[model samples]
Target chain A: MLAEREEQLEALLVEREVEQFLYYEAELLDNRELHEWFDHVADDINYRMPRRLMRENTASVFSERGYYFNEDYGSLKARVERFDSEYAWAERPPTRTRRYVTNVRVTRDDEALAEDELFVEANLLVYLSRGDSEKHTFFSARREDVLRRRGDTFEIADREIRLDQTVLSTDNISIFL
Target chain B: MAAGDKPSVTEQALQDARDSLDEGFFPLEFFHDENLHDLEMERIFGQAWVFIGHESEIPEPGDYARRYIGDDAFIFVRDESGEVNLLFDSCRHRGAQVCRAEQGNTSHFRCPYHGWTYKNDGDAAGIPQKSKAFKNLDREEYGLAHVPRLETYEGLVFASLAEEGPSFEEWLGDFKWYFDVHMKLPEGGMEVIGEPHRWVIDANWKTIADNFNGDSYHTAWAHGSVLDLELGGEETVGHAGTGDSLDRHIHCDGHTTSMRGFEDEDVFLTYPEGVVEDLFTKEDLSDAQWKLARQALSFTGAIFPNFGFLHFGDTTDDPEKDVAPFFTIRKWRPLGPDKMELWSWGLAPKNAPEEFKERMYKMYTSNFGPTGNFEQDDVPIWKGITESANGQFASSQNLQLNYQMGLEWMSEMELDDEWLGPGFAYSENLEEGGMRLFHEQWYEMLAGNDRTDATGTPMNVQEDQ
Candidate 1:
């Protein structure tokens, strides 16, 4: 009974730490603090959001053919640097966005190659407002992520975002989701 | 402006806009005017040979993809007989779309609204409760309506809704040779990577189309971030200073192609090592054509109405990396006077190594795709132009936007003595000659009499002479 109690406590602690990391990441994105957010990502991070297609039920919808974003750490850094330029007209006025990350589910890898790794899945809804309009573009996606423990925190190692819309209704994907 | 208070666009207003083209001006009213937009739907898009999907998209016998010719929905499908067909998406029964999915491999399409079915070849297959529905219905007459004139040039499919107009070759003219450089890579030829990247933007189709028709002048200022990021190198900044690149615009029959000759003739755009040799000896192209293709660092152009393409070389952020060539095709599908749907596709040579293909796709995504650095900057400006053009203060029919950069130097800047390609080649790449040709063609299509035969020559040719 004492060992069972200890196991329960460990599970709760892991969940709490994962939740806190996610919340902190959300805060960084929401504030458009991309440079700081970059620090929380692992050097070998692979971030990708493939193009979604409307296919028949029997056909696979996840295409390996194209992507909205397929970035490694180096490319992502270049993309982030573009935001600082005055000629980046899309974000010149800056888009005000709020990332609402919810339904965070974390599972410790049982067949783990390393004890410091965890698998995570979360639902993300980003609300973006730009120019002189009250109309906001809502972008929702299911994110599958792999987080690696670092010192006292966690760094995103891989992120594959599956967008809900087949045809994105937004004018441009200027904000990182 | 109040509701219902918008000024009606008259034929005379359109004529005035057309006439203004010669004076290096275009009326702002043409940008977002509703009546002009509606007229363009019937006049330009309807009559012109609008590009659909490429043949590579539906390589299999039963493969089909949904596409658009103007605002009209279409299904580009391959039949059992190995023939490609462009069918109107509307069902014969209730006029509902038969193929709702963007793309799929299907032998038949069944409408959900009503159970009317169509074969991949566009023949009506069956209808639910056929015996009970209509005993006298003629099945032969119920097949999907085929686009009157459909043609393919190097796998690029184009369809004209009109029963008659100029031949596809005539419409393409000398642009065909330049287009070949984009499609025909020596070995296996180019194939689209996947389904196109699509998004809607609040901008006029013509505005974006014209931009692709040799509007290099906007690059240094509008896309300065590209140069600042070092993606375009010092040569790009040089163009901004001396406008030396402005001489590359080649004005053909209602089309414009821009090709900047590199001093290093061996500097082929992004092919892997040894690929250039194979490309040079490719049996498909003539020796002269191969020589011309060898000198180009990049080629970009718009094919009249709305089809635009780019075949250019680019490098990653690492300066040590070699420059790689990538190809992309885009169509500015008009949604409304102030709105358009941008459909863009990335393509690579079919025989390229898997790793090289991946790199080519990445290069395309980073530069020109919807989320691309260049595209992200362009969309906002296009939207800004649309918004500004529609405002009350700018609504004056007399308001003209300048198109006068190279007007004074047209005669002196001609490159006829040195250039080898067809078309009137300019001495610089940053000139407005292509834009002028595009507008002249647009005006002719809008103002000329509608052709009753498919063989009728384009009106711009007659007007030019």
Candidate 2:
């Protein structure tokens, strides 16, 4: 009985650690510290956001051939660095965003993950306002991530963002989800 | 502003617009005027040959996808006999939508409201009540209405709402000569990659039309991030009139295409050796068309009213990756004066290797889509222009947005006497004549005249004479 109680406490601590890391990452993105956020990305990160499909019978169907983003480390880095140019007018004024990360779940026993890696799923809601107007929008998505333990913290090794809207309502997806 | 001399609000606005166009300018207020939007829907879109979808989207029998043309919904379907049809989405019974899904395969569409069933080819198959309730009703006369005119060219489908207008052939005219180079270059032709990328934005449709109509001047400044990151070479994304590349803006049959190529070189739009040697054929093209394809590096063009395309080479998503080519076509659908839906599709040669086709699609999303590195900056700027034109300041000040970059007084632009295609080619890319051409067509259509009334001999030719 004591040994089982100890296992439960260890799991709780690990979940808390993961929740803190996610909150910190959200703070970095909200602050627009892209370079700093990039520091937490693993060298072999595979980031993707597949396009959603609406059907009569199925509630959730993603297109096998269509996607909004499929980025390797090099390309994602290029996208991150692009905002530094003054001519990148999409973010010249900088979009203000608030990220609400919730419903975090961590799987430590998945056979597909290594001993040092954890599979995490979370619900994300990002509220964005741009161009000094009352105009605002929200991006609600479900994110599946692979987080690798790197010394004291964690790094995002893989992430798949499934956006909820099939037809985006924003002028452009200038900000990362 | 005299009351006796006053025209209706619309007539006055159109008159001001015409005066501005004659002076190589366009009024800023027309971008978001509600009255003008209504007239545009009644005039331009109602009569124009609007792009619907490519044929490949529904290749199998019973395949169908929902499509739109100026707020009208349609089911682009292929029937059991392998014939394609565009049927109105509304049910004949009570005007309820019969197609529930965005895309699917179905032998027949049964309306949920009253169980009115339509065959994939739009023939009314059955009524639930049948002879018991309404024996006098003729099912033959109740099939869903098709668009007034539906036509296809090289697998690309277009539709017109008006029963009377220029035939599709007459509408395209000499522009087909230029488009043929794109559609006929590869063996087995090009096919759309997947579903199109769709996004709604707050912008006027004309804003993007002007950009696609050869606004080469904006490439260096607006997309500088792509240059700064070395994702694209300078020649493909460089300052106009600065590189040694042969740059020409060609206008034909009320359409425009801007090209960048090397002189007498086998660039072939920088397609890799495998594609160039195996897939490209000279069988369907003339010597001149083959030569144009051989020397081309990039091509951007637009059909009148709403369609645009970009076929580019020497670009990559990552600087470390080898450059590849991407071809994309798009249409801007007007929702309101300040809102439009942008639908864009990526395409590749149908016979190319599977891996290469996937890579081409990757390049397209990385460069041109809603999340593209180059296009992310373009949408917001267009939205801002629409916003600026929404207020009273522009119309009150009589603001005239200048399109005079290539006019006689602005620059001594000349025509290319040795052009090999079926259009008037400007020798230099530093010109805004294409935008002026687009505006002239827009004005002609809105004025209840044939759009071709704006087409004539090139002004540079007249100037030279």
Candidate 3:
């Protein structure tokens, strides 16, 4: 009974902490605090978003062959560095963005992996407005993340963002989803 | 001007547009005119040998992928007989697309709207409730419509809708040698990594085509951030320099190839030494071609209407790593007058090591992919150009864009005798020769004067010369 009570408390704690961490991460991205957000990523992070195809029901819809971003931490940092440069014309006059992260679901990984590692899945709808138009571009994705507990905080070790659109309607995917 | 004939305003406008090209200027209206877009769909894309897909994409029999020729959808499939077929997506019964998926391995396609089915080779296989619907519905007559001409060169497939045109070979002309240099890999040649990264940009297809054909001048300013990153080798950086003799641009027919040779013979350093040696010995590349390829750092160009390619060597941010070679093939699909869909594919040597392929792909994505620093700058600028062109002041046919760069110097700069590939080779990479050639061909096609025979040679090739 004592072990059962501890298990129940741990589930509650995981729910609370993971949800808060997601919200905090979303806040950082929307607030354009990319450097601070980078701190939330593990050094060996494997962030990737492969191209999605509309295939026959018999065929799998995801392709392992291509990706919009198959980035390691160093490459990700390099991309961020470009955003800060004066010559990054795409974002010179930065666009206003908002990320609405929802449907946070967290589950502990197999015991063989680690006690602190968890698999997290969430839905994201990012709205961006650039230039002088009231029009906004909406990017929706189902994100699968591997989060590992590090001290009091969680760091994303792996993230696979499965985007909803096959042919992205936006002019360019300059912002992360 | 003729008996009982009054030309429409569009025809007059098109003629005026053509005349303006000879004067070193093109009307801004040409970029965003709805009438011209519709005309181009028929005159240029309809007649020209537009790129469909690489042969590697559908290697095995029954493997198929849905592709587009301008706005018309088609199925690019490898048939049971080991021949590539470009079939219109429509079903004969109700005009519904027979193949809905982007790509798959299927022996046949069954239309969802009406259960009409077509074999991979475009033969009509079945019609649902055939006995009840019609008494004598001929299956052979109802087969999917195949493109008039389908051809391949070194694994790159192209199709034409028009009944008559120059053979694909004649259309390629000197560009074939250059294409081979980019495609002739060591073992199995090049293959598409996956489904292309597609996105729509609010710009005319011509705008993007012209940029890719030869717009080295913009690299210094528009891609200043990329230059600042210094991810490319010295040759690429030097090509961006404001020097007259840094690179070369070659124009043939409607095709253009702009290249900047490496500072030293180390251009082959982009590839693994083993791979280079194997390709040089085994591939069908000529001695001159192999020599030029060894010294080349970048090669980018367009094939007539909209197909464009870029093969360049770039280094990673890791200081210890050597420069890696990367290739990208793209099609600027015209969605409308002021909008186009950019379909881009990343390719790598089929026989390269897994690690090398990964590095090449990474290098490609980091620099030229949809989210890459370079493309991020290009798409926005293209959008801006189209937006400005649509404005009241710029929309007027009177305002002209200057295509006058290098027009005066072109006469003085003799063709590079040392370059044995083909076409008119100018020493300077930043020249507008490619753009001029593109517009010249664009005018000929639109004017209905450039028709090709079975050999793919333009009917008026001798006359035009």
Q: How much DockQ does model 1 earn?
A: 0.68
For candidate 3, the per-residue lDDT at B77 reads 97
**How many angstroms is residue A91 displaced in model 1 relative to the true structure, after the best TM-score fit?**
0.9
- Candidate 1: misplaced stretches above 4 Å? A58-60, A110-113, B1-5, B131-133, B236-247, B279-282, B317-320, B409-412, B450-465
lDDT (CA) for every model shown? 0.78, 0.90, 0.78
Clashes of 3: 5
Taking the tens digit of each residue's C-alpha lDDT, what string does model 1 give over B299-332?
Answer: 7799888899887775454333566777899888
Best candidate, TM-score: 2
Predicted candidate 2 versus true structure: per-residue lDDT over B82-159, tens digit per residue: 988999999999999999888889999999998999999999999987999769999999998888899989899999
Across residues A1-177, which tens digit of lDDT does each residue of candidate 3 receive? Answer: 999999989988898899999989988888888888999989998899988888878443677788899888887777777677687888867878898889988877556347778989999999989877786788999999989999999999999999988888887878776
By DockQ, the best candidate is: 2
Residue B137 lDDT in candidate 2? 94
Better of 1 and 2 by DockQ: 2
Per-residue lDDT of candidate 3, residues B1-465 (tens digit): 345322223876777677676566877767776677888898888888888898888989999999999889999999999999999999998899888788889999999987888999999998888998866988899999999999988788989898987889988877787788777735577888877888987788888888977887777677767666665555564445344323788776568888876544757536767667654443577877777777777788888888998888755643335667778898989989789988888888887777777777777777776787678888888887777666556653368888776665333444566767776677766567678677777777777777321123222222234
Q: Fnat of the models, one by one?
A: 0.66, 0.79, 0.75
TM-score of 1: 0.94
